[model samples]
Target: MDNVEVPDYFICPISLQIMKDPVTAATGITYDRESIEHWLLMRHNTICPVTKQPLPRDSGLTPNHNLLRLIQSWRRSTGNSPGAAAQMDKRKTQETSLNQSHIDKLIRGIGNPDSQLKSLQKLEALAIENEPRRKQLVEFGVHNAALHFIMQCHRGKNTNASGLPEALHVLYLIRNSSNGLKLSQMEDVIGEIIEAFSWVLGCDGETLNKTHAIFAMKMVVRKAKSAQLRMLKPEFFQKLVDYVKQRGNKQGINAALQVMLDSSPWGRNRIMLVEAGAPFELIELELKSPEKKTTELILGILFHLCSCADGRAQFLSHAAGVAMVSRRILKVSPAADDRAMLILSLISKFSGTNGVLLEMLRVGAAAKLCLVIQSNRESHLKDKAREILRTHSNAWKASPECLNLPTLTSDDVC
Candidate 1:
């Protein structure tokens, strides 16, 4: 069967295998019945894989009997029968279950120091192979085991442990299967997980290990409760800030930024981030013109941090901070614009010292606010921008940056 030159059209695009029961989707692309059904029903993907057009779950799939007959005839010509193919499929399923059993054995051995690294390597390989196996691993509670292993490594100061990276990678691959409610219920476990992430971030381990650590941490933090978030140590925020400063990997930097953003809703975490010099690092990162999503995450964290006096001061202390926020207005994304506006609003309302207001004018922030008022951004954002301009009109109204904009008038200000 492996030596047979099967027709290309007889292959399922989703599974990249020979189609046994070909079915034609509404988009006119034929796929194996099992593969297309799993894609549309199980995976819930609404788009046709081949045509990139809408293929609604409820859409009808007509049986392609002609293609199926041709496929069966071709198989018969190759000395294979439909019964043989069924037997092969049964054998494959048995093999998959056997692999699962092997994975279960490895997961159980993850706690044994002697077999830990080898077990983690095998589990990581299985989790990387396909999504179904990853789901199976999650169902087997591999995430719990991974978290426990990470805590163990942190406790032993095993920064150089060969298993740490594999463990972290396995957790990251199966992160989407995390049960948020279950995690939120386990406050103590959440705390230890956060601590483990902090240890990994602070350790002088390989860059790949740190990257996976942050990625896994980002997932955990996203699912953590507010109570869990409030209990986070200052060192956690400091390590994350340091990770962001390192800028080791693009995805890692983005994950670190997301973790800070997710944890910044609490006032204590906000202060901790500011104390860790987050504002300085964020401004520097933004100045480098990061990707749009990274910029949005950075601004989102800045907006939250700037809600405090120290955070605002820390933000203003960076020469490029205010200017960078202003530059991002109406430039990056609507999310970025929203956060940039909120950050500016915090500065103008809470930390509006004379020097800061003048600097706002100097960096064309006031003009950006005027532009926001006139831009086609959301009404709420425009209103916030107008209010900022109006509140600081006395300082900005006379400046050429503000005066040159026809939208800025005495009536626009109190």
Candidate 2:
């Protein structure tokens, strides 16, 4: 069997193994059932591995019975022994059996100053290998150990500690696993973890470390109670804002935006973020025309920030803020359109000075609102766009740009 040449097409693109249960994706690529399921479901990936086409999480997998039969026939013709299959099963059983004790040992090693780095590397590798391993790590409270290690490094001023990044990566994997890490019951522990993340974000570690740090921080912020979120230090927000302004890695930027959005529901946190100059940085970030999801996140946060007078002042302070929000209408996803419209609605209602309203016309924002009214967006969103146009139509309708738009009506101005 080892020397036999297997058909290249018989191998799974993900696991690179003989196709045991071959299934075809919508993209017309065949992969092993387990491998593709893990890729789509466990890893939460949306792109087909072979075709790089959009593969939704709920996309059906059609079983390739003919290919399965061919592979089985090929295996039988190659005289693949039953003993080899038994050995493979035994190895898998051994791996499953060793996980608990192995994780226990690693957790103990994380406490030891000398073996911390090596232990973290092993744990990180295990966590990355598969979802089950990550769930096991979370079950064994490895996230706690990882957090403890990070806090220790923070206290010891060990910014350069090799284990710090590995520990952060491990924590992120566990937190992001299908069976997410359970929230720590102790408020103090949660606070300490938040502090540890703050230090990691501000530290001069590798960019990868800060990236993982922000990802983990996002999860923490999401799980944190309102009181806990409100308790966040000013420096925490400053660090996140600085990361945004500096434009860290793409994932890091999104995570930071999510963190801000999650915390923005609390008025105090909103004020803190606005005070940190988040509005300016977010507008600057948006002006660069980020990806769809990133744009949604940025617009979502801006929508929240715009709720307050100070936030609105900060958002309106940017010359392109209103224009950017207007441009995203009907151009990005439905979510982006929703948030952008909400932002425009807020500015027009609360801060609609003649100058601001006229600027909205000058920047084509009024024209965009008219487009939204005619767009195939959700009825509620279309209604929202119509309302914005009606509320400010007197100012917008007089403009030649808006006058030419067929959707603009006398009733649009209230």
Candidate 3:
């Protein structure tokens, strides 16, 4: 690791030599700001600035305290540096310039009546000796960078060229973008990636596919406030919520429940649990969350609602609403002692009015619970499930209402 003995295969692509710059490559990857991610994806201290090679991303140069000062200097030179957002209006004429490649594409685009990608290719090739144009191209392209990465994961004969890690880089960008900031009004791109999950992982795609999609979606949801992803447009949030609530495999719920409590803002906290159905009042309460009993309280609220005619109505109407409550009762809190109690509460709530309990009971939910309890490894659960079965069965003993539910079984339970 000494200055003289640089790592092998770690050459900078830009310079085609030892790396140098804010950070240099220490591994085989040579992508830099020009070719690397706009977010300074690499940060190793020394290497051929040109080659952009590196040992590995994990071991790359760590940011030093002076990183702020370096950032300031970069801003000064760029004029339109990020913090200079306020001053952009003053330099409208002199504002951010377009790269030569983009300009070239625009000019050549007039006559090139052939393929659209060929036009883009001509544009991509404008990298040579066109510094200003390159900068513009980079900035403009940043808007859709996440999209291109996602498209790389789609089904096709050419998919092998679209590596999984490369696909993950798109996800990494989505998850780690500053303040969880995401592009604005961009549903088509995000939708394509999510909808194709089953294709990406093949037949086994359902579990892993939902896991990754939920992870990124939650991160974006957590960071949003007063702003939905610009790219997702105004209604896109609802669409994303529906994606998980209905299309998601069972695993999506597990991932949604795993976000750390403290890091979550109240709005996100509420939305995280209730999906998009989180009301403004609920979100406010979630701000003071983590009071030791918050989870229980939320569960209590959920129980009172789950079996009610209105609650079921809400669930049936809103996909997110269904996911929010079901995740707590079934996926996340299943093993908790109170889970069965919550289900019982719901069952009782619907006892006189609606039809959930009757439907479930008719479907042999009583027998199903008994079987689950009997087979459960935890004796406590066995007892709890058995008690619930008994309670449900006996509830009808006193001239009980008949269940109109169609028959369901253990297979459907799974």
Candidate 4:
């Protein structure tokens, strides 16, 4: 890197990395597309990184075609080809050599300070270009190797620090790319992986590194055996909740949400999440425009959290909690609707104060329940919705609006 005399204009202000797909923002400054998008869209920043100018939240990024061509020409002139170009193309795929001996040698070489950097660069290049390479790396125990590599950094071993980031990147890419990868194979190190991720979350690192840590944590937590999931500590859950509150990146937030969902199946995990203030944060997240799966997982966590009184109270503490759940019933997906119903059921059955019931009515929670019953979708969910309405019918029935609306079914035993 010291040998390279790249032009100052070529670096992204946020990541300080060479601009691959350069884009010009409304602020008249250029940035790498991925880096700027992470800043604006993922981190929800409203200011341009370089100019410090206020950017409209929805401002569009214009591609810097001229800068891109110049960068490409420079790379070609520098003979950095093939390697730099391959690394830039995230979607590029390649066939792995599948040489077990070669893989073993790379893993062993990672212990050497000087060689570790070169090995990690090579591995990261291989891991990013294709699924086959990632699969092969996992097959050759790169998962454990990469985890150990990060652990070495934590342990103050491998004093040469050049490749630790790349090693982590490769680890995240391997787990994310390969479907057959399993955490069961590394059960002994699950705690170490969690510890490493907690360290990453707390440390001031590159945004991508923190993002990778959250993704890796999600994968490890999701794939751990049932017993292992139940054994996770509150500190781990607290770290995840902190990540959610930090709102560092969208991918990281979604990963944290997934980790909570995967871990929430355990009763204690739900309490931990609730105690971590996950419900309020999740409700706030829902108010933002999240991807479909993100919304579903958030709702799923809320459903589990609502199972307990503390969770229900925390969820209801959010001003938009009831309204947000009502709005998502028919708008998102079937899975979301199912979970949202359970959340409402828990609140109505246990915490239905007069104010809560009135708030539900005002927020269209009552209307949503009626729609659920009329639609006859997901019979179990419909049944629960009916129970909520009927159980509170005396309160609802007193309302002239409720009286003017549809009549109660025979199931309104209350």
Best by lDDT: 2
Residue 7 shift from truth in candidate 1, angstroms: 14
In model 1, state the lDDT of residue 121: 69
TM-score of 1: 0.76
Q: What is the TM-score of each predicted model, taking all chains together?
A: 0.76, 0.78, 0.32, 0.73
Measured over all alpha carbons after superposition, the RMSD of each candidate to the real structure, in angstroms, is 10.6, 9.4, 16.0, 9.7
Please give me the total number of clashing residue pairs in predicted model 3. 38
Estimate, for each residue in 324-354, the C-alpha lDDT of model 1 and write its tens digit: 9999899998988988999999999999887
How big is the RMSD of model 1? 10.6
lDDT of 3: 0.39
Full-model lDDT for every candidate = 0.80, 0.80, 0.39, 0.77
Best by TM-score: 2
Sequence-dependent TM-score of model 4: 0.73
Model 2 lDDT per residue over 160-263, tens place = 88678678878777877765677665456776788888888888857777878888888877778777888888899999999888876787899899988888
Q: What residue runs in model 3 are displaced by over 4 Å at the alpha carbon?
A: 1-240, 243-309, 314-341, 349-357, 376-380, 395-414
- For model 4, give the 10-residue run with minimal summed lDDT: 88-97
* TM-score for candidate 3: 0.32
Q: Report how far residue 239 has shifted in candidate 2, in Å.
A: 0.7
Please give the range of 10 consecutive residues that has the lowest summed lDDT in model 2.
41-50
lDDT of 4 at 303: 91
